[model samples]
Target: MIYIQLFFSFLKIGLFSVGGGYAAIPLIQSEIVNGHGWLSMQEFTNLITISSMTPGPVAINSATFVGLRIAGLPGAVTATLGSIFPAVILVSLLSLIYRKYKGTTAIDTVLGCLRPAVVALITAAGLSLSQTALWGELPVSLSSVDWTNALLFLGAFFILRKWKWNPILVMCLCGAGGLISFLTGKFF
Candidate 1:
């Protein structure tokens, strides 16, 4: 029964979440956090962080993590499968349709219009995640802020913009820095 619920929940996420994984964050949050109460907002935020740092889509990673937390390995498999199934089917269908309408102006126009909407979805997801990542559930006041995290974010943004470093390298460096901070009791 748990496995079935996990599968269907993620299946809903995969089916309706257009514009990719970031766009699915809100849906995933609603199901696992708000609906099921399986994870708190902070836990969900951490899940997103971990998902971003790992391979595969954020939606798949999140489904697997949440499923494992909820119902072990079987739940993980079911949720991961559910999260990918719609994408696989939709892409297959879209490929055929795109081939058939390869040069149609209507199709081109539709695709062009979708681009901005996708961008907007991604931006909204980022903003939603930022609220948690930057301040957790604390009130939006200067005294309640995590200054270390804010500093890290600013430093990372500056370095990335100035040096255009490889994103993987930046992530690794930040991970190492975080580990060091943890070991030294500088970050909590």
Candidate 2:
């Protein structure tokens, strides 16, 4: 039953999420955190972080992790297969007719419209995580924001802008900083 839920939830996300991996974040978060209660808000944020850092697309990685969390290895397989099903079917079918509409202005216009919607979805996911990190649990006062995190975020943003360093290096540094902070009682 849990496996079925995981498969169908991800399958719905795959079917309806119009854009690529990042675009699925909002829906995946909603399913994992809000809809099914499969993951906590913090877990969802961690999932996003881990997914972004891993090799494959964010959506696939997340589906696999969430599925594993829910029902172990079998759930992981089920969720991954479910998530890719829509894309596989649609792309295969569309490939045959793609040439006919490839030159159409309508196709272009639809995609142009879709771009912003995808951005909005990604933005919403970030906002949800921001709320979780900045404020305590939901339905609570926002009196105690983590000042240490605020400072680190600002510092990282400016450094990234100025240095234009590789993202993997930045992530590594952040991870190290987080570990140090945790050790020092600034975090945790």
Candidates' TM-scores?
0.92, 0.90
Please report the candidate that would top lDDT against the real structure: 1
The whole-model lDDT of each prediction reads 0.87, 0.83
lDDT of 1 by residue, 81-154 (tens): 99999999999999999999988999999999988987887888787777776787857776777666776777
Q: How displaced is residue 4 in candidate 2, in Å? A: 1.6
lDDT of 2 by residue, 49-143 (tens): 89999999888899999999889999999999889999899989878777778978898888789889988987887677667666647664646
**lDDT of candidate 2?**
0.83
Instruction: Specify the poorest-scoring 10-residue window by lDDT in model 1.
Output: 142-151
Error of 1 at 112 (Å): 1.6
Which residue pairs collide in model 1, if any?
Answer: none
Looking at model 2, the pairs that clash are none
